[model samples]
Target: MTKKGIVLWALLPFFLGGFAQEAYFPPAGGTWEQRNPKESGLDPDALQEAVKFAGEHEYSGPRDLRLAILKGFEREPYHEILGPVKERGGPAGMILKKGYVVASWGDTRRVDMTFSVTKSFLSTVAGLARDKGLLQSTGDRVATYLWDGTFEGEHNGKITWAHLLQQNSDWSGTLWGGHDWADRPPAEGGIDDWKYRPLREPGTVMEYNDVRVNVLAYALTHLWRQPLPTVLKRELMDPIGASTTWRWFGYDHAWTVIDGYRMQSVTGGGHSGGGIFINTEDMARFGLLFLNQGTWDGRQLLSPEWIREATTPSTPNPNYGYMWWLNGGGEREWPGVPETVYYAAGFGGNFIVVAPEEEVVMVLRWLEPSQIGEFVRKVFAALP
Candidate 1:
């Protein structure tokens, strides 16, 4: 045989492997591989013990009430719980009420890319800054926190914190499609040079776009004078006693993998539209913090009033809040859900649901991008 043919044969495994690998997309699936919580230098048994305590006790308050809530769900599945949404296009769903895991289907252990849900998490951090007086108000102009000329035009100048939060920024710029971020000219000269196309007058209508959230992250990091991850860790994650093993996947739009875990953080981008890596349990704890009105262990991470305001609908669209998705009303409504239930939904079915009335927090992480609405319905149906 020819030498060239022999060389090609030798390289066949790598070539075939590359072709067989799945493309990086939202909600891709497989299976849950158990990870040693201790290897990440965290005690899995402690977490389990906490879960057990939560299941056994009727939490009163003051000490680890969040853990109590999670344990409650683990004791039993909701009376009417429906699914893992295991259809060919269904979501890999998990149910947690008061912090305990009740049911999980599909690849429950596999970390999946959750797009846009990252926006809600970013909003929480932004809210934290505002709570600390680092950021004045959601009404503050983007120019107040960021450089005056960072964004161009009257619309950009008129862009307020509220506008960005509600998806009413009117800036029609997008970083997707064939548009390459590497190609855009630097922010220089007048704001006009940036030339943002307006969708409507700022604060007029809702249109979900990526750049608005990315810009919000940029503005937030600037005001806090810290990197986005640091701010989030100090203000939100650490306060909630979340797992430290969880790390955000930077720049690669993918899932956040826990230490010693083999999953990737869902996509690497600074934008809040998507780019947070957290485990299902930590996600539940985060939701529980909100459900408890931002207080944990007698300390207020965020003001209760701020929680109400942030989670409540701030626009004509009743389903959206300050980056969170309100669940009571939307194009897809769920049955048996109280009017008070709200959720932070990410693309590909990453859900951190807070139902205040029921004291329920459900976190669903899946590898199927298109089954979000279906999963939402299943969760509601599963409620006892």
Candidate 2:
């Protein structure tokens, strides 16, 4: 049998038995017909050229150097992990390193929904606000900035900015089922119904919920006096050369409500449940920026300290940091990840991984949400 066939046969059992079954492989050229490159104003040739350039140049850093070397020798196993995703059925995937599109096996241009990964980007915005003095500190109570009467009760009043950032708000609600009591409009009754129903106090446990993050979006927009997307575009996205082809899924609609007082109320409450979409290259650029400590080609887009702290594990869970995810510390985390590697991972496998020690950044996008953890680990292993 040929070498390629042998490799496939050897990996078939592992691919089929493990989490790889859920992976969605992209076409060889990384083109997604659903979201065509031309429609998004991207040149496929240029994208390929960029990837080629990245592959040619060698990167030397503390952690990912070996992976880089393996890639340089063309001996790295890129195709193995991607094979299942391609044949079995999954989303398109892309792999980037150091601002270069090194290898892509599937539809790379498609803009898939990156579920909670939006929280990581939003956290960066919040950090910017704090760094620029727009936000005092993570310790500042949310009530200090938002209208006093907006959030009800002691728990809501006492909930600090840091609490929200860490997902320790102690708010008893889930954003997925739409059954979260905290999601109810204030006029309907107020948060008093279930705001303080937490089984534990704030900062004691980590619960992944989107309502708290939505509230954070509301708080930031209220403070900045602008929409979240506008602030991100002007301050963050444009600086990184991100195209405006992205969209936030939930905020696409506008709503108006009539209050009990018969006054028309315009609410901008849909900016939560972060789902921001962008092309593969822009996402890779984001990874590169983090790899370079929030700077790109000499411009300091984000403070170095912020990048450091944001990627560091703040809670007992080694997998979580400011808004990013760390790989080394968690029990069920990525196995081969160096202790220094951290990533901003989105739902459906949108990852902006920064291996500072390795001087590398990797971005991967996939359609199946189930492959997120496994795919990240595979990418980490594939790195030299």
Candidate 3:
């Protein structure tokens, strides 16, 4: 997002005083208990319109997603293990009010690749690292940790954990066989043009590059001394009672030797292939964790301060924060959604939207990008 296009939302506490939310943690193991629209504070018609609007807004992008990723994008799939992804879900969703399942549609149980929503999970892992002192500080240069070439050279040496998390690292070099420039190539650039381009100063420019995000993943894995998926499952997932079905994946090529053992470096998206494949129920649980400011079941899984830092507008990009998307009010991209809302957005229209003021945690998978804001509005219309 451009600097001028971003919006900063400062919330007023009074606006949230009316909707007194009650805690309702779902059972960790089985199908979540459901509540009717009235019980959950939703207008029946408004909730209906939300799903109908999402179903109307199908993937309007180019037809062949795989071909689009490979050729025009020149990015390879993380692995060929999966034969084919079923047709993307037709606007699957689950609405949680006060942590109770208010309404749901489609198959919430289907496991689908959540693309960049994985980044938010990755960021949460980073927060965990800080909590455990794995990372002394976000401002510390990553070169100080790994002496490898990944953080060597002029601009890269200055790249900090914050830079990597916020997409301001602008870190040079290639990893997992994907170059930095390969993400969003210039209108006029040949292969040579992209490969040899000058590096943007670290923590200066915010460019959305999967390779850079992957770099963050690799570095975090090294620091955690284990696979990110393992860290996530043990630290945050299990504690919050997330299911065993969700999985985090990395490209087959993205492997590194850490602590005398080789481990896969997970990426943040399904742009290539692997990321986080999770069910909507699990995604909603994750969202609810954030909605309650990282507290789940009276336990502080993620520190409240970390959530603030993760959601705060980065100097480089107001629309992003620690791999999470900020919903400060803007003219586009969730225009009608409340300013206090922050969400984990991914490719193919997977979104985990959290509206704290409304006590609403919503998950929408495989909906149209243009209709996300409208869907959120429909949800809000249902509430007071």
Candidate 4:
């Protein structure tokens, strides 16, 4: 080969790599910079229409979350508020393309309860633990690390980290005043029947039980040797330049003594109350982290492998991955959207959608729950 041909071949990789890294990443704090919609191949008029549709389809529930929680889960026996809850603001959202804000609406800075979106954060905490070698593999039984009676029984003993993350643990017990069977009880069964029903083997089914979710949080707290919130702030939020306004909380009575230090074990959702209370920008930051395959700027905050495992569909639930919801052409998928898209969703219509192929991170708060698919479809329609 000619000398020129060899030189061109060596420079080819560098040129391609430059294009891969050209997307902008916002600074840690202050105002997030904006980019023209045209640059991202998005139609400005269609993007505005998407924002308008979000505003017009506000969540129908009362702004007073206390009442909303009570009414939403009234069918569950012994359901009652046990933690902090605040009135929520109206519709707020932000859309980012290549880490630059292209469109936003409402009060993006308003902090409010994120409900089950907290699960995805909790899942991240677990990922950090594994990355640091706190606990071994996700397939390892929980009883190996947490020998303190939480996983003592036959059904519980078989539970693994992956099972808990996938919401297929079917862990039968009570934690922080929440009974596993009492959470989202079957429509026709009484308490006696529901409580004593057959237990499915761990990892064989997906059940959205807050009690079991809190159990995972409890185990993770023991593994980390500190409160989950503190670990998150030091390791994630602060590094990502998140505001200090966000807070994570647990039930009022959920405290435990660890290594002579008394600390609270946070909950994974705001079922009774208390979870993540964060604004849209922070949520977008998190989504952007995932969209970039766990890298921020150039530093690796989370391993790409961890992010991939967290988004990959689990066996029992095609629409769920380590707590993040996947759009894997399942029943929950948004029609016409790419299956590569995944999101962190919560009650009351809060969602942080990360579309890797589109280089988009969207935060939506308080849109009608049933309209999410249609809302997402509209957002994708704006893309060329």
Number of the top-ranking candidate, with lDDT as the measure? 4
> Could you give candidate 4's per-residue lDDT for residues 1-384 as a string of tens digits?
899999999999887565358767778778899988987789999899999999999999999999999999999999999999999999999999888999999999999999999999999999999888896799999999998899998889999999999999999988877899999998897999998999998999899989999999999999999999999999889888899999999999999989999999999989899999999999999898888777778878889889999998999899999999999967788878899999999999999999888888889999898988888888899998
Q: What shift in Å separates residue 26 of candidate 3 from its native position after superposition?
A: 0.8
lDDT by candidate, in order shown? 0.55, 0.55, 0.80, 0.92
lDDT of 2 by residue, 29-78 (tens): 33322333233334555545434433333122122222322342232112
lDDT score for residue 286 of model 2: 65
Supply candidate 2's per-residue lDDT for 187. 40
Candidate 3: residue pairs that collide: none
Say what the RMSD of model 1 is.
22.8
Tens digits of per-residue lDDT for model 1 on 213-273? 6667656656766566777787778777765755544333322223344332222222222
- lDDT, candidate 2, residue 115? 47
Q: Which 10-residue window in model 3 sums to the lowest lDDT?
A: 76-85
Candidate 4 collision pairs: none
Question: lDDT by residue for model 3 over 1-384, one digit each (tens)?
Answer: 554434322233334423334667787896688888887667888888887877778656543556534543443223232222323545588998888888888889888778789899999999999988889989999999887788998888999999999999888877766767767777686778877888788777788888899899989888888999999998888988888899888886777888799888888887777889899989999999988877787788898889999998888677888998888743334666767889999877889999887888989987877678778888888897
- Cα RMSDs of all predictions? 22.8, 17.5, 7.2, 1.8
By lDDT, the candidates rank as 4, 3, 1, 2
